[model samples]
Target: MGLARRIAGAVFLLLLLALGLAAWGRFRAPSAAERDALELLRVDSTPLPAKNAWHALWLLDYIIPAGEREAAYAQDLAQLRDRAVAVRAGTPVPPFRKWAENHYAALPKLTDDDRAAICRPVSQCLAQVRTHPEATRLALTRHADRLAAIAGLAGMDYLWNDMPPVTAAPGPDIGDVQALWLTAAASDFVEGRQQEGLAQACTSALTMRRLHVGGNDALGSMITARWAIEAGGLAMDMLAQMPDDAPVPAICAAAFAPPVDADVDFCEVSRAQWRGSFGSVENFPVVEHGAGGASWLLSRDQTRRLAAPAFVAACKADVRAAELADAHLDDAIQPRPTPDFIDRIGNVQGVDLAVAGVPNFVPYLRRNRDYAATLRMFGTALWLRTLKGDYRTLAARVAARPASVNPPGSRPIKAGPDGISLVMDLYAPVDGERVTTVPLPVPAS
Candidate 1:
């Protein structure tokens, strides 16, 4: 009897403790600064839920990649996976039957032959890209036209037709957005179609920029920024491979140029918002760090205010890093600070950075994009001079700074086996070699 009474008493004590902890958690308040910071952090928004237009795309089987036929193939795949159950029961699977009927009805009524007919031109163009460098420009033009047509059929033409600030209706398959542009740029450049390559590459860069521009949605914006970085890098690569005599119009360079002021302005606005989010929460619910499972405990706001401001600084750091990278694009030897914002931003808490209007990925993406564009532009300039005269002339031209041919760290250009090279370092050394030779095309024997 006594033991039972003791057990009841212990249980009562435990219940009382739990109630006390819960009450404390509800009342714990953040400091004034913390409140302001919380308000600020809350400024960035989630992407608007645009109507999914992917179903219309799925209606065209011939143009879409197999991986992208999710809606069209889902029902069929599920039925096949569950074939044994249906066979054993010798009964029609009602759900699969309905799904299959609906899916098949919606799919385009094109036979295999019809599908092949639609794809023949595209296939031929791609084959030309693969086989004959002599026919590159024509092949690329045909291919781009064919792709544009297919994109129209798939309801994705807006990506090419529209500019930034337009939403992809039934959002684009974000995974596949850059694939075609990257391929086009590489193929065109290798085939000696410099103008075409530049056009395609620039189009890709513009597309990426358009995808996220003017939207405060962090994830969507960052995704666009990442693709922009990739597209910009590929654009530079194409430019670097162009023959010296290849014409470079002002438009080509302008394509890769980002509106730096707009980006900086956006960051400033976001940082201000992150600093402001903390003002509304009276008490922050502190999670109790203990062994008997976690519980919230309300207490006097005790969070150190340093992390909030530090996080905002980190966001600003990412923008500045991007700006620095852009400033060096026309030169070789990309200038990087010894301790970059990327390094500092990485050390910041992920939540703080994300909430503070710059995710950790932004700095890394911006830095790489900037460096790639700069290096490629430098290579292109040197290659052009090499075509005009001998290696000595190339060195003299670089020294003279006839164009924006300055090297990073003011590293002097040296004569290479073929033409000239910069014995320069890159950000985040690959294979630990700082000096690399930029090979120029050899003259016809």
Candidate 2:
């Protein structure tokens, strides 16, 4: 053969070999045992992507420098801890300002007085929330600026695509700063600072709502809304503890607006978001077996084609289960079965439902909405108590406001055996009758 003909023959042979390997890679499925082992991939509970950038920014400023004397702000924390211990011993406590000092001095942009002004209200607000008898010392008007600052920091929206990829495990866990505003709101309400308390509560609620946003990563975005729901639940629990006749402030009423839709649309939106995030990452995890004991490692995609379909189908089912549960809430007598079938997809050889990080989010997203729905019910119950002296009058008042008394996701509120506290559950009594009970602790006479 001539030189050009020989070269063409070699090229054709290489093309044939490439095609054969591609075909095998596509057709070969993992063994049953390997499928079982793949479930281990689901255990990767790394921190949410937001933790990365937030932590880096926080440490650069608030972290104490090496070899420096502890700042006065640091001393304030120590003093507060000591004071908290003393309060337990029945020691007389001073006014809010005495036990703490402003500590936002670490920020370079604010001047000394500006920092002091900022820190002072935060300190006092925290003290009020901590249940100081002298909470009346600070005017509610003083904390307006501080609450604004806290709201600003809580974040208006969470942008998932902007999140830098997780290069390594995240740094120290930051306490949820938004909780402080919540505590302040609860304290103000109890102290008769209704307007201010409602403002603080509203700020916290709106801040939580801000976490809902659009992005490529569906699980991460929903995680933000889910967090808002959990936080809002805490706020509702606080309101429930108030007197039945306590006038509901307008801001509190507004804050009580549902943080997210509690219908089929929510479930559909969450599943679609997860779909966008599916397989978007370069480093998909894997399991390896040989002479050595089996282990898991994060490698770029090598066998995703063999595993992804079952994983995605499982994810869809899990999301659909939540939707189905919501759709039937109006008539449900028992709690809907939370789907965990995805987690046990291949149990025969011990590998259950296995998936990469993106799909692993389905379980978390599913549970979060449930918790959110329960919080919404708690708020509704509080609203009911505010209008009537109790929640049991719903049947008589249904015509006054049709569909006004939907329980949390069709699950009724069950008062504790003592008939004082409320919980979100449906225990025995399978007759499908509408169950009703007061969720709040009965106020003292």
Candidate 3:
């Protein structure tokens, strides 16, 4: 009986001790690794969310910028929710939907073969989209004042506070957004407004670039870089449409000459991923909203801690990957994928998809470098076109900008037997590298 009593008391004491340790672990200060991650993730606090291009984009639902300037975005959501509910319940289709169905039924704008022929390859479509009898360009121009306003704010910061993943939309086909700007630019050039035309072209690219630059999770940065480099393709096509004697402004060349990571820092983007993306998962009862994982806690923190090594490693990896932005694809260094693991303590904290945001940053880093290289080629080609005073001048001028003309062995200007086109060895993580050509519409003066 005495032995049984002692065993009972001992078990009770151990239980008490375990509970104390659990509670302490849950609330303990962040560790050295945690602090370093937090420091890297910290962001500037000034930009007003109202001015964010993210909110201003109508395709993203014209969010906070919808109602009267002072009206709450909640009002817009309430109206939209009620409308969506009504539609789902079999109410008559909204006029906008009818109109959209007429011109752009499914995404990729598969209105018909005619529309596709006119706008499928954005490089080919920028000049002709305006000519569609149904006022095809209106698909973009309908949001004219708003588009212009958003473009004007491109250089400003976009601050997206914590938002749940369930409510968040990954955003529309932003490639269409770039096409919109390039079309407007082509229109300006045709009207003999060269200065204003190129300025609009640069601004539109900048706007699309800013749309995703520091805003969304890892996917957001990739979208921005992907589309921005795409803008270079369309812009080159638009430039081809310009008359040979057309002057290339210094601003137009300067705007595109820098690296992709110039204005937005990829490391800071990971910080934001933690703040907002984790909030997406935190909506689940199992997660906490703080910036870092508390080691050994049987909660989301410890589960997400598995992502820490990858997130921290990204800062260094980005620098290394970017160094090879201009090198050949075979020469680009691949950062090893960091695996998520549970050291001796973990039992069964399930992995959250949101936790993968930082762990999966390697692809985004590679895309950034590729975009930088592609942009360099685009800028270098633009520079040569501006300098090409007469026939066979491209080679000499391309050689002059050694720093900008990467992988110089291969001539970017493909003056084929029939015509001349500016080309870049565009790199994609999946398809490897392919020569992307933008045919110049100008006569070789």
Candidate 4:
């Protein structure tokens, strides 16, 4: 054959070999047990029976940090040893008997070397249970140490370090879900190895924050806030496990710091004005001046006209409270605004008054006829009434005999609209006295 044909034959032979190798690999993939042992470092026997104790221990590991893992494991192991002793001493392991049986039954299936490896420690553990139950507790400690060593050998500590930061558009992504799954897998591994799972959780949280908070077009602020709260809660739980006297590193302490923009106040004048104007005129009756008699009389309409500004002021106050609640951080305590200060001009009583400015005539009656219809259209009557109710309840509670009714420096009382007025405090509380108060700008009536 010519040189070109010989080269073509050689290429064809190589391609054929590659295809054969690929087929062989597809057929020779590791079995489930082999794959699991390779991946998790232990065989998951008895798939039908859930590993309850193992799962609980895993959850504990996830919440706790690596530095505290061995200690926590030792404590848990001691308790388990005690329980096991009680079990062997005719203490019916009714709830756990099935689990114990399954675990023991699966043990014989392990290779002789694997059996010896696991059995040596377990036998030692059993002996301790039989004799010096208290001293046998150390077996748990030794087992934890061994597992930790194995994890270290497997480079498990790199799990979190190797993960890339998550960044995606506001919507969900399969990649993000996969990253979370991997984090969970790492968490499970750490738990199985009796290592700390907090690091895994923390890494996952940071990834979530990056995906949900730092990225543009990311999740809503509310979603980000929820995750932040959950992450902070987890950190707090871990911190709680440490002794109060234990010296906490500055970085760790800083993790618990509240997020910026925790407290916010916003004022909108236009909406407040509209609401107030609508409220004042809402329940009033329009009167028409007929060709009857020219007589100037103060009618109910005059009272309502005067109260329009007050109604607007109350609307402004309600808006402010809603804004405050939405923007305030979980740790913030906001006092309910007092009803007296809700509106400078109108009291709750004026909201239902008739239009008062015009002289009493036929025109007044005509205008009054449309009052209910206008009020219903404005949408302020119900909202303002609710605000009034909230203020009243808050006022009653706060204005009670003692200033210390709810306790000093406690969370601010939340008021529904009916009792909303109780929340206002123009002046900061001083040493047993109301100091000089700053006047909040009132909207035009």
Most TM-score-accurate candidate: 3
Candidate 4 displacement at residue 411 in angstroms: 2.3
Which model is ahead, 1 or 4, in terms of TM-score?
1
Ten contiguous residues minimizing lDDT sum, candidate 4: 157-166
Candidate 3 Cα deviation (angstroms), residue 284: 6.8
lDDT of 3 by residue, 260-358 (tens): 444334665666555554423433224333465432334455434444444554465446444344433332232322323332123133244323344
Query: What TM-score, over all chains together, does every model reach?
Result: 0.45, 0.49, 0.65, 0.21
169-255: candidate 2 lDDT, tens digit per residue: 232222434443455565666677765665665556545454443323444445445445444554554555566666655655554
RMSD of 4: 34.9
Order by TM-score, highest first:
3, 2, 1, 4
Question: What's the CA error at residue 341 for candidate 1, in Å?
Answer: 30
Candidate 2 C-alpha error for residue 299, in Å: 12
lDDT of each: 0.42, 0.41, 0.51, 0.29
Q: Which has the higher TM-score value, candidate number 1 or candidate number 2?
A: 2
Runs of candidate 4 with Cα error greater than 4 angstroms are 1-170, 174-219, 241-251, 262-445
Residue pair clashes in candidate 2? 36-351, 345-353
Taking the tens digit of each residue's C-alpha lDDT, what string does model 4 give over 1-445?
Answer: 6999999999999988766654443234444433432233222222242212222222221334446544544453454555545643446543322222222221112234322222122113222233443332333243343233222312211111111111220122121222222223233322342123334333433433332322111122223333333333333333333332333334332332222211111112212222223222332333334465221222322233343332222123443343322222221122122222222222323222323321222221122112111211111111222232243333353434232223234233333254322222212232343211111111113
